[model samples]
Each structure stands twice: as structure tokens, then as C-alpha cells.
Target: MEKAKAFLDKLTEEEHERVSRLPFKNDFKFYEDFALLGMHVDLVKPGLVSCSFKVPPRLTDGNGNLASGAIANLVDEVGAAVIYVEGLPMNVSVDMSMSYLSTAKLHDELEITSRLLGRKGGYSGTLVLIKNKTTGEVIAEGRHSLFGKPASKM
Candidate 1:
């Protein structure tokens, strides 16, 4: 519509840059890698995944604490990784429940653990917990639900 087009035309140069839209043709890069930057996998096994990371300023909320959005992305990514099956497409998030218990400041080491609660057909449930490595204080907890299509017989 003309009205919508006019509204889009009114976007400022800075606004356009901040929008983060990218061409989807080829050689695309993920925009959210900063959320998982410096993460180190400490352990992995059936039904469980554990990792550690140090909070970086790029992931902060400008108040010296990790941003809530970054925490949610971690829950989604790590949570899905816990239940991943070989030769199948990646699981897609169905729902997420998050509880932010405390804040994590820059350079604070974080311990993240994800456990598979269960799986039925293509639906899976996972629990992700993030804690401060030094104090062992809970930073956030997430219950994530995901669905992945079963691999077909060739």
C-alpha cells in the first residue's frame, strides 16, 4: 500500500542500519552469534549438554548485565542442541518459558546446562539452567519445547 511504502521510506539511515535485514541469497551470516561467543563445551552425552561461557560486553544491556534476549537465545540454541538427532533437520522452537533469577555482569563466567526432559514422536521438552560459575547462583532457568520432523527412510 502507498501508506506502508511511505512509512518505510521515512525510516532514517541509522534506523535502516539498526534493522539488521540482510540479503538471503547466499553466504549469509548469522546476526546473533555474539550471544554464544566464547562458549566452551564442557561435556556432552545422551540427553544432556553442558557448556561454559564468560559474559561479554557485546551481550550486555548497557547496565553492565547480560541482556535478557541473549539469555533466551542461549536457552533456545543450547536447549535444542541437547535433543538433536543425527541426520535430521534442526528442531524448531515451539514454546519457551523463562525465569530470570539474577543478573550476570561482564566477564562473569557462566555455566549452562541443558537436559532433555522427554521426547514423544517429534516433540521434545528440555530444561536449560544458567548459573554463575563462581558463586553458583542461578541466573536464569528456561523450559523449552521444540518440534522436529522425523527423518524419512531413503
Candidate 2:
């Protein structure tokens, strides 16, 4: 609570502006439903980042179950946000793989955590895990490979 607020407050003005420029930042519907679901960002370092999000109804699929695509998108967004937050040039997802470990029903809050794994040349990799908030059950996992390049290249 207090610690989280302090961390957010500690961000430099430039960093704050960069994050605010994120595509989803101005989306009220996204914020009201999906983005506000226990989202947190921890900047580990340049080219390194960690982020998590709690699953919510808006992120569920037609069956009222956690949507795999939505989980993948969340992981992708967080991973990219890390690079953007570092004031580095933009990067694009070159490849991504998501594996569902379990199903989350409506109203079941789950946390998805992502971390940078490694990088080589113009390629960066990340690993993400989604877990049930209360039971610590793994609901899904993802691996992402991104192509690093200047923002102008995008």
C-alpha cells in the first residue's frame, strides 16, 4: 500500500511521462476493467523489468474462463512497458508462447508476473507466470522473444 505508492512516486518525471504515453494508459474502459486489476510494475534495470496483474472478469473469454489470448497480451504489454520505461528504443514481439496450466473462473483473481530472461544482439527474451492469488496455483505461463530496435523502426 504505502510502499507501492512510494515506489510509484519515486519514478522520475520523464519515466512517468513515458509510462503515461503507453497505448492503454488513456483507455478508460481498459483501466476500469482489466488494467486496474492489481497491476504493478517493478523496474529491475535497463532492459530488465517485472510486472504483474490480477485477472478480472473483463479479461475472461466467452465461456467465462480466463482467455489465453488476453493473458498473452497482458504479458506482452508488461514486457514492452519495461523496455519503454527504461527510456530505450521500442521493441516488438518476434515470438511468444503461452501455456495454460489451469482454468480461472469469473471473479477469481489471478496474478501474472513477468521477468526478463536474457538478451542477445537485437533479441530479448522474457518469462511470465500466472497464478491464483489466494491458492498460489499456476494458471498459465509464457515465454516471449522480442526484436529490439529504435522506436523509429516500428
Candidate 3:
């Protein structure tokens, strides 16, 4: 909780107000409070999701480019959101891989599209593409495999 408090302490007045207004408070607190990903879920369907957010300065690397870890966090969280929409039980990531094609600078508007590849008895695969919203340039691609607990088990 110290980290969350410390991060909150550094937020500008406007940013603090924006964070305070987040609807899904408990659900995305880590991403919003720590990762500083201003995520907004635009659409969600059974097997697909579309999200958009800006890369906050706090998420950038020393060179002022979006950090790889931040990109991975977005990919992972967005994929999990897709799984949740598909009526799957809570899941754990079994495997994940990312391919970086381009870079996004701090505050870049990013569009993330995630699609579920297929679901087997206990596992599902997902693919995601992250692109620059204005230029439509692909920045990264990600693949994730998740293992879901059975509804009965849950």
C-alpha cells in the first residue's frame, strides 16, 4: 500500500481528480495507481475486446519511450478482460509472448485489440495487437495462453 500511496502523492491535482473518478476502483487500482495506465475499455464481446488508453509519463523508460513492461501489462490485462467477457472462470496465465515492432512515446494514445483464438477444455489462447491511434502503426503483438479453473471448482 505504500507504493500506491507514494504514487498517489505524486499525481498532479488534475490527475488525482481523474484517478479518483475511475469507476472500476478496486478492479483496476494497480494499473491506474501504480502502472499509471489510463485504461478505458471501449468494447467487449464474447471473444474480443477493444481498449484505448494513454501511456503516462510514469510508464516510460529513461529514453521517454513506453517501457516494455508497461506494454506487457496492458497486453496481459486486456487479454484477461476478454476472457472474463467470454464467461470463463478466473484464470492464470500459462504462457505469454510479445513481439515489439515499434515504440510509443509518453502520452501516446494507444489502441489495443484482443481476440480469443480458441478455447479448449481448460485453456484458451488469445492474440493482441497494439497500435498507435493516430498513425495506425502497429507497435506490438502479443500471444497469451490461460488456464481457467472450472466453474464448479470456483
Clash tally, candidates in order: 0, 0, 0
Q: What digit string (tens of lDDT, one per residue) describes model 3 on residues 1-154?
A: 9999998899999998998775455765754457534678898888999999888877889999999998898788787777773464578899999999999998889999999999887788999999999999999999988887645444
Number of the top-ranking candidate, with lDDT as the measure: 1
Model 3 CA RMSD to the hidden true structure, in angstroms: 5.6
Give Cα distance to truth, residue 82, candidate 2, Å: 3.9
Could you tell which candidate, 1 or 2, scores higher by lDDT? 1
lDDT of 1: 0.90
After superposing candidate 3 on the true structure, give the runs of residues whose Cα lies further than 4 Å from its correct spot: 1-33, 85-89, 151-154
**Residues 57-103, candidate 1, lDDT per residue (tens digit)?**
88899799999998998899899999988888898999999999999
lDDT (0 to 1) per candidate: 0.90, 0.71, 0.84
Sort all candidates by TM-score, best to worst. 1, 3, 2
* lDDT value, candidate 2, whole model: 0.71
Better of 2 and 3 by TM-score: 3
Q: Model 2: runs farther than 4 Å from truth?
A: 1-38, 42-52, 150-154
* Higher-lDDT candidate of 1 and 3: 1
Q: Per-prediction TM-score, please? A: 0.79, 0.64, 0.76
